[model samples]
Target chain A: MVSKNQIKLISGLHQKKQRFANQLFFAEGVKVIQELLQSNFELEHLYTTLNDFQTVHASKRTVINEQELKKISALSTPNSCLAVFKIPAEKEIIHSGLILALDDIRDPGNLGTILRLCDWFGIEQIICSKETVDIYNPKVVQATMGSITRVNVSYVDLKLFLAQTKLPVFGTFMDGENIYQSKLPQDGIIIMGNEANGISEEIEKTVTSRLTIPRFGELQKTESLNVATATAIILSEFKRNS
Target chain B: MVSKNQIKLISGLHQKKQRFANQLFFAEGVKVIQELLQSNFELEHLYTTLNDFQTVHASKRTVINEQELKKISALSTPNSCLAVFKIPAEKEIIHSGLILALDDIRDPGNLGTILRLCDWFGIEQIICSKETVDIYNPKVVQATMGSITRVNVSYVDLKLFLAQTKLPVFGTFMDGENIYQSKLPQDGIIIMGNEANGISEEIEKTVTSRLTIPRFGELQKTESLNVATATAIILSEFKRNS
Candidate 1:
């Protein structure tokens, strides 16, 4: 049984400001909640319809009804469970081996998918511009499918970070060298741009290597690939021969 | 000025049953609407807040306020315009070139993103299992970002189609040959499976070539890639050498 105050607090966590203020974010479903439990994340509380998670201390979990679950769930169709975890302090950026840099990626879904891709490709670290969507956003946590536990993501001033990094910075462009023909390195930062815009102008200036994924479509009218998919292809190419 | 009846009709198109019964679907935003207008799609009507699409006959266009546009829109935030178009007859599936076979891809966004990827990679034809999500879903039309205009998508009995085809059939699997080291053909069908259930057992028997995208992550904990991103990587690998 959830109190009205508890419901209001969980709902407020849906917003970035509220999440930051409380240092709390919630993940839905058994899979994501389990992953967080196994990782370094600290459990603030758990609410579920089922009598699961026997390992969790009784004080940390509450057996709630479906109606109660729905009240706190961000998803239109509420999952069986939702668990709130404290947002750990940001870790130091691991500056080696195929770091992905994001230049103002605004979509929570895209950011989450990119984290999963980085986890898949063994790319450990992600550097996001301050303008990028907060990783603790519920949609992102859902989309990551528990990959949030595997990758290290840090939000920073992207232009300054790019300017100072010793590693070669790569970004895709239409006039750049074909990625298939280019010799990719094991250690570099691959920058993916915004949905509506490619990499920002100032960020583009800091890029040391410009690569292009050649369009095979007949008309070449299809302007761009989705950022998450683009990250998948770029990561695949960089790691294919490694 | 859209009448109450017109608003109801547009809202009904959100459902597959209503869309099929009416033989029409709607697209939101200026770019998507403009692409459909230029293509074979016959415009049923257009509603816009702006005085754009000057080429469209005045009889086919209506100037409406943002509130009215919201009433007809599927998005949380309505674009400047929405246009309904006659659902064109499905074209014959082209038997040649690299074909993308989707086995019950249920997400409208994934379907749309895959269509866009196919357009980018020059894969002109897509064969969808009858169980796959409708290509004309409003979310799909929006996510396609106008690539729906370039690619031809047809829904059919995917298993039977695979059994009868003379070309080699390919599908990704956990124990399959590593894609990077394998010899990929330019004229074959690549099957991407359902979001949660990979490929169905019956359809798995029809795949002549089994390939896998190797995982590079240290923990190998990422269970799978999103269907659209997987499609992007596979298509890139196949076309890179050509």
Candidate 2:
């Protein structure tokens, strides 16, 4: 049985500002919650429709009805459970391997999908511009499919970060060298741009290597690949050779 | 000015049943509408806030306000315009080059992204299981941006189609040959499975070539790649060598 105050708090975590203020964010479904439990994430509370998650202490777990679950759920169809976890301190950026840099990616789904791809390819860190969507956004957390626990994502002044990094910065552009023909390195930063716009002008200047995924379509008018998919191809190319 | 009946008819096109019943579907935003207008698609009507699309016959275009567009739009944030187009007859499947086969791809966005990828990679044809989401879904159309006009998508009984095809069929699996090392053919079918359930058991039998996109991450628990991104990577590999 969740109290009125608890419902308000959980719902508030849906927004970035509220999540930052409380230092907490929530994830739904058994899979995501279980992943968080197993990771370094500290659980604030757990609300479940089923009397499961027996390992959680009695005080931390609340058995709630579907009606109560619906009230606090960010999803249209509430899952069997939702678990709130305290947002851990932002870890230091691990700059050694392939690091993905985002220049103002606005969609939560794209951000989440990129994080999952990073997790898949063993890319440890993602550097996001301040203009990028917040990682704690409910849609992102849900879309990550629990990959949120593994990746280290940090939001910083992207231009400044790019300027100082010793690693070669790579970004895709139409006039750039064909990615297939280019020699990709194991340690470098691959920057993916916004959905509507490719990498911004200032960031483009900082790119030490510019690559292009050549279009095979006959028409040549299919504007661009979706940013996340572009990242997948780029990451695959970089890793396939290594 | 759109009449009451016109609004009702346009709104109904949002559903697959209504779209098929009326033999029409709608696309929003100038870029998508313009692409359709340029293609074989016959425009049923056009509603716009701006006095644009001057090439369209005056009789077929209506100047409407934001409120009226909201009433007819399927998006939460309506674009400046919406144009309904006749759902052109499905073209014959061109089985020659690399073809993408979707086994019950249920997400409209995934279908759209795959279509866009097909366009980008010059994969001319897509074969879908009957259970796959309709290509004309508004969300799918919107996500495709304009690639909808270029790619040929046909829904069929996938298992039968695979059984009869002369070309080699490829599908991703855990124990499959590593894609990077495999001798990928330019003329073959690459099957991407359903979002939750990879490939159904019956369809799995029809796949002649089993391929895997190896994971480089330390923790190999990352389940699978999102269908669209996987499509992107696989398409890249097929085209890169050619």
Candidate 3:
């Protein structure tokens, strides 16, 4: 049974402001919750529909009914469990190796998908502009599929980070060099731009090299690839050759 | 002003069964509506708060307020316009070129994203198993962002389609040859699988070539890429060298 206050608190974590205010964010489903439990994220509480997660202490775990689960669920179809974890402090940016930089990615799903992509490519560090969607957003945590535990994401002034970085900064542009032909290096920052806009003008200027994923369709009417998929292709190219 | 009957009719288009029953689907936003108007899709009716799309015949267009739009809209934030279009008869699948075959892509967004990727990569044809989500799903249509006009998608018995296809058949798997190292061809059916259970067992037998997008991340615990992003990478590899 969940208290009324607990329901309100869990639902509030759906918003970034509440999450920040409380220093807590919740993850749903057995898989995501289990990952959070195993990682460094400190669990504030756990609610389960089933008697699973027996390892969680009695004090921390609540056996909730589906009706109660629905009250706190961010999903349309509530998963079996929801676990709240304290948002750890943003870790120091690991500058080495291939780093992904985001210039104001607004979508929670895209941010989550990009994090998963970063995990797949073994690119550990991600630097997001201050305006990018919060990684702790419930939708993002859900979409990450526990990749949030794997990839280290930090939010900073992107322009400042790019300006100070010693490594070459790469951003995609319409008129840039073909990525397929370009000699992509292992040690550099790959900047993906906003959903509607490509890299921001300020961030674009900081880019030392510009790359283009050439569109092959005969009509060539597609304005751009979705940022997350574009990231996947770019990371694959960067890692394939390395 | 939208009549009660009209509102009811348009709202019904949100579901696959209703869409098929009425042989219609609706697209929201001026951009998507305009794209449908410009393409082969026949407009059933157009609703807008703005006096745009004036070229649409007076009888076919209705000026409705935001409240009216909210009633019929599938979007959380209703766009400036929503247009219902007749679902045209499925075009015959173009057998040649790089044909993308989906074994059982269940997600509407993933299907929509793959369609956009196909448009970007210039793959003209897509064949899906009957179990795949309907292309006319509002979420899929919204996510496609007008690329639905460019690509030809059809539903068929996927196993039979692969068995009879003269061109090479490719599917991604854990033990498959590395896609980066493999010589991808211009003419073949590259099959992407369902989100949870990838390329069904029966369909696997028909795949003549198995390819894997090698994971580079150190931990490598991420089980798989989202179907759409995987499609993006696979399509890029096939088109990159061609």
Tens-digit lDDT string for candidate 2 (A105-218):
999999999998999999999999999999999999988998998999999999999999999999999999999999999999999999998899999999999899999967
Comparing candidate 1 with candidate 3, which one achieves the higher TM-score? 1
Candidate 2 stretches with Cα past 4 Å from truth are: none
Error of 3 at B111 (Å): 0.8
TM-score of 3: 0.99
RMSD in angstroms between candidate 3 and the native structure over all alpha carbons: 1.0
- Chain A TM-score by candidate, in order: 0.99, 0.99, 0.98
Off by over 4 Å in 1: none
Share of real contacts kept by model 1?
0.85
Candidate 1 docking band: high
Give the clashing residue pairs of candidate 1, or none: none
Count backbone clashes in candidate 1: 0
Question: Which rank order by DockQ, best down to worst?
Answer: 3, 1, 2
Give the candidates in order of lDDT, highest first.
1, 2, 3
Put down candidate 3 lDDT per residue, A1-242, tens digits, no spaces: 99999988988888889999999999999998988899899999999999899999999999999999999999999998999999998898898999999999999999999999999999999999999999999899999999999999999989988899899999999999999999988899999999998788888899999889999867998887889999989999999888
**lDDT of candidate 3 at residue B233, scale 0 to 100:** 90
For all candidates, what are the clash counts? 0, 0, 2
Model 2 TM-score on a 0 to 1 scale: 0.99
True contacts kept of each: 0.85, 0.84, 0.89
| lDDT score, candidate 3 | 0.92
Could you give candidate 1's per-residue lDDT for residues B18-100 as a string of tens digits?
Answer: 99999999999999998898889999999999988888999999999999998999999999999999999989899999999
